[model samples]
Target: MWNRLFNKKSSVQRKILVSFLGLIIFPLGLFSYASMSVSKETIRKKEISSSLKTLELIADKLNIMASDLTAISNLYFANSSLYDLLKPPQGLGIYEENAKKDFLIKTMINYKYAYTWMDYNTTLFGKNGFELHTYYEGRKIGLDSIKNEPWYAEVVKANSGIVWVSDPSPKLIPTVDDDHFVSAVRILKDFESGTMLGIFLISVSESFLYKQYGNAVQDYEQVLLIDDKGIVISAPDKKMIGQAISSFGERTNKLADESGHFTTKVNKRNMLITYDSVGKTGWKIIAYTPLKELYADIGKIERLTILLFLSVLAISILVSYFIARRLSIPIQRLFTSMKKVEMGNLSERSDVTGEDEIGELARKFNRMVSRIEDLRDRVSAEQEMKRKTEFRALQSQINTHFLYNTLASIRSMLMIDPPEKVDAIIVALVRLLKKTLTEKGEFIPIAEEMDNLRNYIRIQEARQHEHLRVVFEVDEQIMHLKTLKLLLQPIVENAIFHGIEPKPTPGTVLIQGELSDNKVWFRIRDDGVGYSGFPPSDTELDITELVLEQSAGMGLRNIRDRIRLHYGAGGELSVISRSEGGTDVVLSIPAIMDPEELKL
Candidate 1:
């Protein structure tokens, strides 16, 4: 089936159409694919890079806040008054003790005002049953309760240094509000004696964590702070603050890297996760962006690329079609003319006009058909008159003269022209004479006829001393098509001698042939001196009238009679005098390939 579909001969038009489509569509499709791939990766990388940078910034800010809290703790450790006040109160007057308590409360209030930005609550626990609070004033739980707490042990183990407690339990921070908080716990000690005094706790509200990077969070994105234990210390969603980070995703374990980014599924949704370590805190600042949201721009680009590719493809197809039509239509016209000539149309001429190969073929076809008509007429007259012997002698004499003239032309070229060109002209003349004298067939392929015409033209070019240009435009389709022999040479002879030879300057003879309306039409136009009496730009005229009015030569008269005898009313001959000082000769004949299809 494939062979059957593809085996048929393709027309020039179809081949051109397919070639143009391939040229445009293949490259366009490849370019579109490459651009989409590059653009997708580039956009994804750029977005990921930007997200990682933001995560790093969030980590840096958290480090800064942690440092500030540590600095505040150091201040408390340096204050001798704080150490003395936090130490156990010795036996003394009740009023004195009360005054000492008042002094301590005032000092705490002063420190709160001094660092209002920290927005932290402080609790001081003396060795005695004394507890003093700042914001959580009602929480009077004793030192025994604090020592029993899980995080309290972690603080004591720090050996007088500060310890950060994330996701603090309610018992550790018995505040009036239900808001979550993280605490910085440290031992208050005497600077001089190095004696431990009391435990100091600074509880930072959840607002502190959110406020640090709240504005950085976007829709469908998560910003989280996870403690060393992988506990969610801070997050946009308050409920998630105390939960294990692993609850978000099993792949969260990959966050073990000090700082990096990866793609994973979180809560069953694909996510792009970027993490950075908070400075010296053993905690991670992480950004979670849904992959869908992260690559949304890439999606848009994909759609736009497809749209552009389709648009360009559509335009390419349109342009290719027009180009193919332009290139193939002329060939089709020429093919039609060849078909007409093949059908025994002795007067058939191609009307295709151009300096291109196809145009040259048309001119050659027209000239060949004219020569055939003239030969047929001569043959018919000779038979009627019963003068075959005399006619043969006369034709031999004509052939001798023609060969003599060509030899003279070649001899003249040897002196002024190059040896190679003279040699080529000699070869052309030999071939032209051989075909003319030796070929006996009345009808020959149009291709052979055009080849003979080419040889004749080459000899003429070498023969002419002046600038004489001849252009023949004929279609290739008619090359193998049959036509009467010896058609083109005589007309070309007349065009050179009668038309171009008279012009003083350079001149051009154009021969064109094409098919129209089941008939082959040919035109021979020369930019040279035209005949005196013919009307300028004549489209149609009777051959007999042209012969009488213009006193046409025997060659023209014979060709006209032959066309009439062979093709009846379908054969046409016209001679026009151009307004621009030239001559236009046109010939046409019915398209009939088979002898039986002929009117005769």
Candidate 2:
């Protein structure tokens, strides 16, 4: 056996030690690389997050500046003095081109910008849209001529009380007359008459946001001032000052006010980016870091892990070479014994004699296989016996139930009825017997079952004339749906026999079928002697008598048991009735099955 084991080991192309070593070594190298890469990713995300915080601070300040600008614009547009002056000649407006006594100092205080002014014109279509009237600090120091400015016509053309932010325009400076002052302009007016013949312009420095947030962060990170349209209203970079951020704007349109971080390829390099938005203006702040730079230390760790993994692989191969040989003999015996059992030689046993754990494990395994064989035989016999028991129970309930009752009814009809009545009675009895015995098959179409039920009810009516009125209201669509044989008749018979027969006055026996919620439900109800107040679960009710005593309730117990057996516990025939009125026996069953499955 030792010589054979040596020969087997030599014939193998890949030694077990080498196979084991590669398994341990390869995953270690891969995991080490993956761990370092994940660490790098985490670091990159942290940096981007930190930068995003700084961007948020800048974004908040910029949004506040824009809101404050809007507030001031609204205040100017709502000014009543200016609003009354722009009204039609109702005696409330100023008629001069210069500032009046009441407007002189107040307008100066409100319009604090260097070249701020309120200009007026005789007509909206005048050659100059507006003539400078109330100028702050004089046009000599920092003044602007609105007559020829591109914004002058635009501002005057718009109706008063509306703010408009125009494109960049030129304004005249004090010392340098040609040095244009950049400004945001709007129109001021009266509320009574929507007339506009003047302009309200605020001259602001071009480097408004850049001078404030330009040096707030490092060169690696960016700070942007975005407007409602995601346009770069102001920024440190001259090129990006008025440019739009379409990508960010598009994302904002998709995700409203929610904020998060993401890793995506930007300019062909992987970058970690995080951003947030000012809810009202749709302005955003974005911070980014290069993934490779953030994860550089992780890459170093990955290289060290790979080197360590390779060394471990070598040491493992040296150790496992002798270890694998030591255990190979024991494992070979398991393979041999398992093959014999798989080939139906259940008597075969593993005989790897030893004092260690493997020897004990082999002994237990042999014992377990022996018990498994014994269990197989026992379970087979038990299942066969269970199947027979179920069929016998169903047969007992179906066969002996209505047969003897039909015979007794026939004997009574023969004694009292005439010849013609006897012939009709025999024909109906034959049809009822065919249905009860189910000579056609165990399973019948629902339409056939209804025909059988009509015959049965007719014969019963012959016996108990006007004592019971059986009314059937079956849904037409459910006529072709299949169900178990005689699933409902037993219950209906019980309701009439137990519930309605004892009542003094003739009572209604109502049988209805309908397709509701993909299932067939038949309600056998009777407005008759009603129900017993006794509960089925109560111990005093003699459940054995109700179940097996062949009393009026015996058929109902049989019906319920058959339903549970066929439907595997989900199907049921539950009885619900109201006292002194009617009893309703509900028979619920599945309605559809393929023809092949129906055979089963």
> Which candidate ranks first by lDDT, i.e. highest?
1
lDDT of each: 0.74, 0.61
lDDT of 1: 0.74
State the TM-score for model 2.
Answer: 0.38
lDDT of 2 by residue, 1-600 (tens): 435444555533235655676677778768876877687768766776677776677667656655555555565566555544444444443455235425633554555452233221111111223323233244321213445665466556655423323233333433112222234456654454544445555444436546546777666655555555566655556566556666543354532454567777767887666666754345566555566766667778777776787688778877777677677767677768888888866778898878888788788879977987788779868965774586566656655666666667777888887778767877997877666664454556788788877887777787777788988899989888777677777777777777777889888888899987777888888876655544333122223333334455667767676666566544656566554456677778777643235224
* Candidate that scores best on TM-score: 1
lDDT tens string, model 1, 1-600? 434333458777777777787788889889888887887678678867887787788888878777877877777777665655665666445686678777877877887788777677777787766677875666477787657677877777797777778745666456624367777788876666767677887778777878888888677788888888888888888888888888876455687788888888877888878888986567888888887887787788878888898898888878888988887888898888778878877766777899988788878878888988899999878774653454344446546756776888787888899999888888888788888777375456677877888888888877785568999898665565555455556567667767787789888989787767877777778888665455555443333465435543445554565566556687887766666667777777666565346736
Candidate RMSDs in Å, in order, are 23.7, 29.4
The residue pairs that clash in candidate 2, if any, are 83-189, 83-190, 141-174, 171-181
Query: How many clashes show up in model 2?
Result: 4
Cα deviation in Å at residue 22, candidate 1?
2.8
